[model samples]
Target: MVLPVGRSFYVTTDYGRVKGFRYAADNGRPDAPVVVVQGGISGTGQLWRLDGSGWWQSLYDAFAETEDLQVISFDYLGGLGGSTTPEQPLTVEQHALAYLQALEKLGVDRIHGWVGGSFGGVLGLQAASLKQGPPIDRLTVIGAAHKPSIQSSLLRSFQQLLLQNCDCEQQGVVLARALAMLSYRNADEFERRFEHPDDALEYLLAQGERLLQRHGKQANKLFTHLTPILNDYHIDVRQITCPVQLVSFSSDTIAPPALVSELEALLPDCDSYVSIETPFGHDGFIKNVADYQTSLSQYLPQLAETHV
Candidate 1:
């Protein structure tokens, strides 16, 4: 099946608004199950592209081949994408509200699944816990927990300090991103890929430079605004009534398997908890797609017969 072109739309929220995208199912079933997908803090609604440049292109490709499933995603407020820049940072609950508003605007009264990774996974938990808005039947959270880990928080706090104190803010952003790249992947990956220390340094710097080039001015503010919110996050897993599927990377220090296991135990109804073994660490969700794609495919179709 060919990937559908995404149609962009605007969603107005209480705090602000954001741009959203919808990928209609090729099966053209009006009663097709709708799935909402979200990525990390830097992620946008453009999950698939004809040129194969989408951030989640591999995952989206797998979804596109699935029968009778429509997909939607959105940019966060104050994000690099075509979203409103807020004066103050929005909390996780506020971000969830914005996502709910987007769904309502798109006439999505109920969702079959909510697939999110990293910060996006946190947003999914908050959204599913909401008392109002459409009910999500199933939730698939990858590499995220109800709260940020202590180490992850500390790292981000340092990044915030760098952004706040540095004279050259762009350089600060670059440096912060470089530091983040370290946490995103594990030592095993570095050991296998880089023959020397200089090679690893070059790779990290290049990753930071690439982000700076892609997002430009938005990079600094977006990093400063959204990065700290992870620290402020605290959710009652019992509130999320939907059956949850939790995926964690074995090497992920940011959102480790232990954190996801805790979440699984607290969730009202946990369908499954999968820990994919990969060296990619926190980035395994995107980097090691083949490893976890089967897990997602198995879970997504479990309730398909009940959706329509």
Candidate 2:
């Protein structure tokens, strides 16, 4: 089922006003459950574009085909897409508050589910912990932990440092993104795909160059602001009261299985923990959805029944 054009809206957040998008389900049930979907820091509310350029197209397609649900997504403050760029970076808690405000503006009293990956996952955890928003009945976090791992923090810190001191800001963005690509995927995948060292380097450079071409200077600002926030991110899992489903990749160095396990142990009502083996590492959430789609469907039974 092709999703209809998304309706854009504005919401007043603590830092400033931001843009949001709503994809009304084809079933058009007034009482249909609303599911909030989000991606990484660079991700936008446009989960799927007709041009096939969306960041979460695969997962969004799976959700969009489920006739019983509505989907909402938003851009982060100071990040790419239609959201306002804040004078200063916002915290995870602030982002979560803004997400709730966006839902409130849309008259969403309750969320059937909140599905997020990477930075979005941590945002979901922070949102579920907040006491003053509409209740989130279920939370699904993929490739993220309650806090950034020390190794991930160190890698990101270097990226920020490169951005701060490089001769050309654009080059800095390119180099940082290239460096990030290395961490996003595991060495096994790199070795398997790039038999020659030059091939691997070319692949990383191409990925970075593509990002710059796609988002321009906005990519730099996004990395500059969001990277530091992610490096320092931490959430108290005990505060979250909703049923939570955690998904992790075995080879994910950024948000490894160990870190996710820590979060699972702390969550007040963790419904399940799923760790899928994939050489793609942290990026497996997007790259190898079929590997864990069944596990994910267990949390969303409606999606399971319909998708099958």
Candidate 3:
């Protein structure tokens, strides 16, 4: 399934060239309020996925669906899609600053709302903490943490090790992606999705193959660039002044609900903590889109009433 995307735009910054996509309402109102949506590391700025029926539909579209705002999304500085390679090693802080720089270039002085999933969520928090990015009226984070857990960090290290040692880099990308599937989902989901070990293996193999086939040689570089960002992500939540909404899955191993919950205290204006119960683990936010939409619909309106 391939989601259709618009022509790419570039924002050159100290980090180098950053590329992004823009989604706006039909009126083409430049003055429309803006919302930013950042996807997981594996995905590009194409917010929707092509379903099996060959239709492009966004799993998360509440922001795009809103009549009065524009939606902007971008790739990490050296990520798999859209963006180009960075001149220097990337850090989470640098990634955040890159997005801010791009937004500034785009003439977005203030963000109406910022929604990020997984690593994208971490970037959102980090950007907010910088206190130097565009003003953020509200932030919605899905399955993100202020600091990664020791377990997730170790898992990423093992992935990096696999990538570092392999003679064939694409093979390494496949293996690392397969391993990452384990962290993205929980045992219960595995049990529910597959009838047997062989079935599970087949699914993982298909996922890995799909990743390699889609990204090709760029796969390894994407993984290499993202792991460092994951390891270095730590935010000073007190610096965040915007209203925040945290949505975490009960079964997420990468960003467990407890760890995500901790952000509620540190964030000066956290408005809500929504725990979504699902066996899908870290991927629950994607797997259960309706649930997230319900929450966002209820919360985003408040942003307009109070902050817009």
Candidate 4:
């Protein structure tokens, strides 16, 4: 197995300790501009640890080679190897505080940019809006909104119900995750990938099995506790003063274009809104990273001058 190559440490926070990893840029500057890349709910801080076979390997390599750029990322406070399981439900503000405290511990007073999608994106927004956290210079949000839409909220509620009704928590998590996959992807992807009904059924079952193996029996409890926070995510956008770029996929159902548009109008300093066409739905942020990067490059000249 290819393991993550970096130093790992923990930082104390209001919620608990957060696990983080630091990747120094090869440009040989210790005081380099720092960029934070965060992933969705099912991910960890080790997301950028790319092997050659993974889709993200090229994207990781691209940033790793950027001059005077350092990347720092941490796992969510309640997930995997990060902090202990939440004793109570964690709000978006609490999640933001944990991330702020982690960076404070690392002596990061100002962030060059913060990139996140879905759950991570909303958390970034919440963090930037807070008066107590480190200042963010630039922000990139992909397929996320200030709060869950009515359709998305209803779907999550159903997933939660399914999780609570199962006899085995592991099985429940598997089912819930499978259902979430449907939301992450569009109908066109399913039609193209599966020729027959049996293939589709098999694929979903496999994905569920993988989740069960990765999360064990605690999967249901963890998601059950976290779902409400995701649904209730809200922040005062007027508080955000940094330039922001919002990217939404045309096919994304969870964080659709209309919701992203509403978020863009609310931001006091929104730089641009780029809508990309993709069949991957809400997961297009990862599925079409090359296109996403192309959109981001438009702001590169601006970022460079700001850092200089």
Candidate 5:
């Protein structure tokens, strides 16, 4: 079921256009404008995932089947998808500015939705509280923070350390998968996914081996990456005021559903929430795309009626 998927590209910033990715116009409706953002790390945009996170695929397969929707995505600075520009003092605000400039350059006036996962979700929050111009019409953020928790900060520190000292590709993947899977859920989801204790270890071992085989060696970029992530993590989310629709995986241990509770409490206006009780945890937000389409389809009409 190859649903209509569109081109992947990048928008030139003042720094110059680096390659990014987009998914646009499934089933022949180009006018319906939506944009997607990947998280803040150096990872490639998940227009299609060969590895761990398959959530983007689920999102597209669900939306592309319907007509009248246009979606786009991109890679952020310091990323493998970005140019090697010094980017002089990159911050979340700066990142949002780049995205704004791109939207302006593309002549996109307003958006039906601004969607992001992880770091992408941070920018979405920024747009909600935008002081510069018109706020985004709607926000859909899954597993993002207005601020990093203590554990999250510690993990970021460890990632930076790995990038600097060990620089082991295998270690990086091992750390990433371990940390990421842990935050995504508690013991419940893992148990379900593995079906047995020994199976879980086997699954994790297989997962780690495969990941290290590929992306384990991104330490060069990771070393260059740490500061920016830490900076973004410290941003004050109080500025975001736009209407929000939050999604979380009960299994997601990284950006736990509890974090969403904290964010919801802080938002100028409390909004909606949907939690997918899957073992998939943080990655589940991206991987379990089918569950989301059903969620979106049911909720969107309600959102329009209420917001409109």
Candidate 6:
């Protein structure tokens, strides 16, 4: 049996140490390093869990099992089960700081590529621009944008408002889940998928549970802090020195195609950006994995190529 790579934990510039697992073939070769940035507002170490049917592992499975690559990722401080919590207001910059710390502590000098979607994509662009930390050879940002729309910000604020108004601490789970499902989904996708649903009650209940799962219970206050912050979260997409490949979809109303184009123009070293022909909506990363994989196959190798 092929042995899976060993997993481990590391400390950060915060309250508690983070837990993470890596996957790489044990042949003495230096693994073609890469990182997978998760977009969930809550914790998603499960995405990398090889034990169960994890989403990330499933995505990586598309590549060669023996493909040597270091997969390093972690839960954000404010994320569901991340080891630490920020005492102060959480900002996009602060979250990026935590992610950069993880890459550094892991001894990853540079990543061959970075796969980011939504929030993670925004952070990736910021990381590449500073041209600091690890040398990011390639950038793949999907369902992302250079700025947050006023509606997006207000939507997040409403979530915090709901959480703050509630008297119970358990309400955090509800707020987190609700926001997660709503944000996780591309609004346009919903209209398309639910038009002919048979069990309206079950679907509505699912949405409810996705949000109010732990109502009346204590929740991480970071959710409250982050809600309003999303409104102010915007990144200047130009400073990156490596090639960038953006994936835009027709149905992604949140990060519209136009915004993607505008952001693409800001990249200093971008190789190219493509808009996919899919009705998969904004959350296409999870919905349309094959389309992204096909694109990555072309993008990653080029970034890894030695020009000299």
Question: Higher-TM-score candidate among 1 and 5?
Answer: 1
Candidate 3 off by > 4 Å: 1-7, 49-57, 302-308
| Sliding window of 10 residues with minimal summed lDDT for model 6 | 213-222
| Candidate 3 per-residue lDDT over residues 55-90, each given as its tens digit | 114443454445566678887777787688876668
Candidates in order, TM-scores: namely: 0.94, 0.95, 0.92, 0.91, 0.77, 0.81
Candidate 6 lDDT over residue span 1-308, tens digit each: 11233355656664345655555555624445565555545434545454744545545544444345556566656555545556666677766666666777777787777777776777777777765677887888887877875556666767677666878645544554455456545555556777654553356446646444442222454466445566786686766678888888776656778888888888776676778766666667666777766666667763233211
| Candidate 6 lDDT (Cα, 0 to 1) | 0.62
Compared with the true structure, what per-residue lDDT tens digits does model 4 show for residues 1-308? 11234457788877887888766644346566777777777766775554544323434633643655667778776665455667887788988888888898788988888888787789878888997767988888988988888888887888889877999877787888888888889899999999997898788878888877876765554575566678887789889999999999999988999999999999999998889999999889788777777666556543344333
Report the alpha-carbon TM-score of model 2 versus the true structure.
0.95
Candidate 2 wrong stretches, greater than 4 Å: 1-4, 301-308
Off by over 4 Å in 4: 1-4, 53-58, 300-308
In model 4, the Cα lDDT at residue 250 comes to 94
Which segments of model 5 are wrong by more than 4 Å? 1-4, 26-31, 37-43, 46-55, 82-89, 167-185, 191-219, 226-238, 298-308
lDDT of 1: 0.84
Ranking 2 against 3 by lDDT, winner: 2
Summing lDDT over every window of 10 consecutive residues in candidate 3, give the lowest-scoring window: 49-58
1-308 in candidate 1: lDDT tens per residue?
Answer: 42557888897877787898878755556556788999998888998888888868878645766656678899888887888988999888998988888787778889889999998899999999887778998899989999999989998988888778889988899889988988899999999999999999999989889999998999876676788898888898899888899999999989989888888889989998887899898999898777777777778773333233
Q: Residue 63: error of model 5 in Å? A: 1.0
- How do the residues 1-308 of candidate 2 rate in per-residue lDDT, one tens digit apiece? 33645677888877778898777765566567788889988788888776776768777556656777678889888888889888888888888998898787778899888889998899999999887678998999999999999889988988988888999999899989998888899999988998899999999989889999999989987786788899776788898888999999999999999999999899989999888999999898898777767777768765776767
Clashing residue pairs, backbone N/CA/C < 3 A, model 6? 43-80, 169-217, 169-218, 170-217, 170-218, 174-211, 178-211
lDDT against the true structure, per candidate, is 0.84, 0.84, 0.78, 0.76, 0.60, 0.62
Model 2, residue 177: C-alpha shift (Å):
0.7
Better of 3 and 5 by TM-score: 3
Clashing residue pairs in candidate 1 are none
Predicted structure 3: lDDT = 0.78
- The Cα error of candidate 2 at residue 257, in Å, is 0.5
